[model samples]
Target: MAEPQIKDQRGWAPVDTGYLDNPKMLDVLDASGTAALMHLASVLYCAQHLTDGHIAPGIARRKVGGTKDDDRLLIDAGMWHEPGHDCPTCEQPEPNKVYVHDFLQHNRTAAKAKRASERASKAAKERWERQRAEQDTPTDATRMPDALHPAMLGDDSSNAEREKERKREGGGSRRTPSRPLPESWTPSPSHIEKCSKERIDLDHEAEKFRNNALAKDMRYANWDRAFTNWLSRDWVKRTSAGLDPMKDW
Candidate 1:
């Protein structure tokens, strides 16, 4: 059977369901008697350290507090195999070491775990780079239009002509500059018709509008629009209330 591939081994260790019911495990449990826990502790220690089921003598004695008698019991029960034994599953056996039977078959080796970690890191880095590149690349909607590009303007004359065309089309970002109220400013015919329908005194409102603009030193890009807005909003209400429109200003 092919071994399962492990991409990351940080969290868990594999244990078979029939582990306690196995004949080899039964023999170790029965032979070790009161010392069975120590022998089992050695197995857990190897698993936690990702030793591929191999237990060093020093680790068994000092780390797991297991004596040579415990190792002998596991080895004799066929639960563990001594070094130099002809085991087909052992990858690189060291001298005087004992390996757990079928450890590699059930769990990840240290080498495999290291490789999985490196692969995960490399994949994460590649994903980050791809996302950053996508963000840095400009899409069509965000790119500047070729017609408005400064490099496409060619010269001063062409630029001025483009500006005039844009203003005529009323489709550019720039707005008309404002100036102080004109000395000859007057309400247009449309303004007169609107005021007449609304029963507003057009000439009186017009004179008041001019006086207020001059008194406040106001400026506007479109004086006609400003006067129309002022008439629509306040002139009718003030005249109905019998309040002088020029009193507030």
Candidate 2:
């Protein structure tokens, strides 16, 4: 023989056989009436119809595999309540409304759906905030590199960085000795002769002066002018002024 047919339903529903312990219910209702009440309870989970714990009489009877007679039995016993309110989610007016009494109290499925919707909404908001934050935030690439910033435009350290970049690109430790002196300072071989007398290698000294000035980030419109002035002072101090003949002429 075929196994006893199971009741048709959707998703999940809760049933508490514990109510069977009620003395009046156990003694008064037959099995068919009890079964009808349970069927309608599950049907109330359908938000499209039995929303908010109410069900249309025809749907309840049809799905319950009972009749209007079965429903009347439940109503007389105060087991069912009619549509008096709308579901927040479904929004059915009274004409289209059917509600289950205490739908929230016993329907775990509806409660679960509500919680899930709330969680989904919250997650979407957080994701949007994170994305917006990432967009508004800036990156290191947006800043000008220290090497490219003009010496006078930013800070004292910028000039030093600029000089280091020049050295890296042009090579360090040795600089060209033939660089021309600044026109305004007046150039002559006399500075070289004076340095030679002092036992200094003029070319090497000149190279060192240029490199040291650059490393210290000495700023001038013409570095050549500054360097020539420096050499002129040292040359004048070191060279003799005609052997200091004194008392005579």
Candidate 3:
């Protein structure tokens, strides 16, 4: 019947609303001729420690700061049971312990509290395991495609051959293919307006551009851009002196 020791003193213990109005409390109060604070303190100490109502003699004296006379008073008031008393709730009685009378009637036993703590710990562990499993599982979106799986697995020779084939077919190069200027090509309307604004003869410039490209066998990806470049760098305005504009270039 020795009081159990507890490390976790976290939760509240129940106290009846009419505790002070009880006959036993009234008797203890009358007998003590004082507040009877020690009796209430002992009851709380047993509850908080999950001691099953058992109070050690050393705890009553040293921890609770109760005198022998206080213990005697509570015992006389039927609020405490002395050591060596037969307890129906306990399988065997300890010789060096005192118990708060009817303590289990109002509070949880040590075994029950321990079981609840264990169950809570088990549930928390299971929840954490489930969360870990969910995080480790891969989704379909993140899974590698079957077509690219071999490439990812370091099939370097096949990958290199495919890259070379792509280059050979002009599929891998970023540049546009070059071609000779077309015989029927004409200046776009915007370029025609630009030449008119600058007083450059569009027909004359067009004839010279086509002749120059054909003469040199020059090739370009964008013929319009090539024409624009030719206009900017080579075209000359007709002079009033009657000299050929091409001769001024």
Q: How far off is residue 3 in model 3, in Å?
A: 8.5
As a TM-score, model 3 comes out at: 0.49
Q: Which parts of model 3 have CA positions greater than 4 angstroms off?
A: 1-4, 7-12, 31-35, 84-93, 140-249
Each candidate structure's TM-score, on Cα atoms with residue i matched to residue i, is 0.43, 0.33, 0.49
Candidate 2 TM-score, C-alpha based: 0.33
- The lDDT for every candidate, in the order shown, is 0.66, 0.49, 0.67
Q: What digit string (tens of lDDT, one per residue) describes model 2 on residues 4-108?
A: 223223345555677655543453256466445544444543543224454556656555577666655554554554444333543232453344545556555
Clashes of 2: 5
Off by over 4 Å in 1: 1-11, 33-50, 61-63, 86-92, 131-249
Model 2 local distance difference test score: 0.49
In candidate 2, which residue pairs clash? 52-100, 53-99, 53-100, 54-99, 54-100
Question: Where is the poorest 10-residue window by lDDT in model 1?
Answer: 144-153
In order of listing, the candidates' clash counts read 0, 5, 0
Off by over 4 Å in 2: 1-13, 22-50, 83-93, 96-99, 108-112, 118-249
Candidate whose lDDT is highest: 3
